[model samples]
Target: MQTTTLTSTWPQTLCDPSGRRQAKPRNKGCTMVIDKGIGQHAFADMLSTSGEYIDIVKFGFGTSTLYPLPVIQSKIALAIKHGITVIPGGTLLEAAVRLDLIPGFFRQVLELGFTGIEVSDGTINLSRTLRNDLIRDAKSMGLTVYTEYGKKLFGSRIDVTDFARTAEQDWACGAELVTVEARESGKGVGLFDEHGECREGDLSHILRVVPNLDRLMWEAPLKEQQVSLIKSLGPDVHLGNIPVNDIITLETMRRGLRSDTFELQQVPYSEYMI
Candidate 1:
């Protein structure tokens, strides 16, 4: 797929200052931005400025239902036009399951022009069977499914074995990607301690089980979290729950344009080699 490069002046004399970051329609190095509330004009501005860097646009929480149906449709259409997959928050789907409105929820989302669904159990208990079935159902409708593994509560932690099993099953069932929940706060939750520092042991365990990191989306809402993951996992690791405003900044980091990741670029050593 030929998509636009991050730079406007491609094939220039100088290479990217940071390094070569992948272009759009990328399988790896994808970035998902969290949108709580942004109107059409601002959304348009964001896209025009840094849309190429964004892979997915998530309408966070039940806010997708807060807008007029027309406005929602327009936003989804705009993202789709820019080749970005737009998905409502998994919390909305969780609510549907709670009220037994899964079918209606799916139908309404599709009708509203969402190109994807987030099957997550962050706030509630979801059985494996239902989770699998939900993935199947979403895929059956021709929508992309992104499943999430982790809880929304502050003290909730991930059982490594269960997470591995769940991630495997979700992918096998038809999810395009699986997210490790950090919520928007990114504190005291999956892979993160109370201070929002990543638990290396837990992360290493998941890495050992999964092997490939492409299928995983680490929700890193904080800049520190984003920098740490990008540094540890390399530029291609998929990151989610990013604020809309941070899209360009994150892209810069991925390319080593930011000081936090400046070493990613290949630089020549010394001028004086006497």
Candidate 2:
């Protein structure tokens, strides 16, 4: 019965810019990590070390199907014990749905102790109605439903209106959060350009239209992208697709402990600057 705590002190130069929100075990501003088949010991270590910063852990792509069932079960249990939700990637679900094994997939996932589910069409084409139905079904099964937006491809452009519309619809259909997919590479997809840089105009447009930015998770796998997003969206903007090794680093950036975002809280007329 181990639990992780957010004990890191806030940097004096960076104030909490997210306003009011739940600390941990929270519903908003959640960080969902994409796991790429790390071993049980490594997973446990991650939980023991940086679990406080992680809200959800997704078995990236179809990696869950590749692992031994026992390993998956143990990982799920460990994550839940740390108060973090665990789930298989949406591509696996899409495969299950395509092969008509979705029912079996959900049953096995629950039996294995997963606390959440991601409904995404990154590698498959899912109609809006079907996606909505899947979200409803996942919610009915008592799984925290995290739906995703955007395709997994090079040069995938995000339509601000479409993204905003999908976000609203998914929330209405019981999705806990809507992920903006940048894939594992975090480049040439969603709002990210080919070099893993975020397109500011697209981000600004989405922010203007999307009612609650907290419900949107940007999949930023690169440090530069993470720094930029955190600086622009504040510490609590939901981010995903983070590499396993960078969990602590991302937390440091969020808290302004890292030099990249250490200047988020300068006074309007600072004594030093004046």
Candidate 3:
């Protein structure tokens, strides 16, 4: 078996002046890719090229159910070998729950060798009890559970208090991380407005209310959204729903390689220098 090794040395000229960038095996600043459907060779190529920068890979809605069993299994195996967690979108899980196939769903998911599970109610209505149940159940099956908040409607907005409470409850229920859903376009969902712009006020409110901002993964799919978030929450904020091609670009942004946040590349000797 082959292994992937991440380089620790960063360009000296690009070091953060504040010295706050994080490396891999991190609890925060996670980057999750959304895979609609890519071939096995292409998927393997992606993992070989940028797997270290990716923390999770979501199969994106019901697309997982459409793939050939071998392809799905191969992808999951590649990701697991790279220490990346791979799972189907929460919407697929929701479909199973609605059809009363939750047990079969879990069995099939485990059989497929998926190491992660996303529990979300973006399109359906789930009671608090049911939501917690899903989290507990997934955890019981030895899956890394990632629960999502916020609806997918165009004008939907997040209630800071409710989100905070739900986030805390989900964490207590054994969820590894809670994701804020912004969908693929990243517009008109969660804290984003119609133009794919983030509502700063809403974001600040959530941060103020939530106990640990690190536990929340914001689904930012656009370059501008990624820049704005890195600026607001620093490079350590967990971001998900990232497009496949943008993985390295997002990593560059996080490491101050991009002009959007070039100012972060000035590490003070007192902080980062040994």
Candidate with maximal TM-score: 1
lDDT of 3: 0.89
Model 1 local distance difference test score: 0.89
Tell me how far candidate 2 lies from the true structure as C-alpha RMSD in angstroms.
Answer: 4.4
The candidates, ranked best first by TM-score, are: 1, 3, 2
Give residue 47's error in model 1 in angstroms.
0.6
Tens digits of lDDT, candidate 3, 1-274: 9887977886555454335555567786899999999999988999988988999999999999999898899999999999899999999999998999999999999999999899999999988999889899888889999999989888899988999999999999999999998999999999899999989999889878899787889999999999999999988889999999999998888878778978667655685577
Per-model C-alpha lDDT, please? 0.89, 0.85, 0.89
Deviating ranges (above 4 Å) for candidate 2: 1-22, 265-274
Tens digits of lDDT, candidate 2, 37-66: 899999999999989888989999889988
TM-score, per-candidate, Cα-based? 0.92, 0.89, 0.91
Cα error of candidate 3 at position 55, Å: 0.5
Candidate 3 wrong stretches, greater than 4 Å? 1-21, 267-274
How many clashes in each candidate? Answer: 0, 0, 5
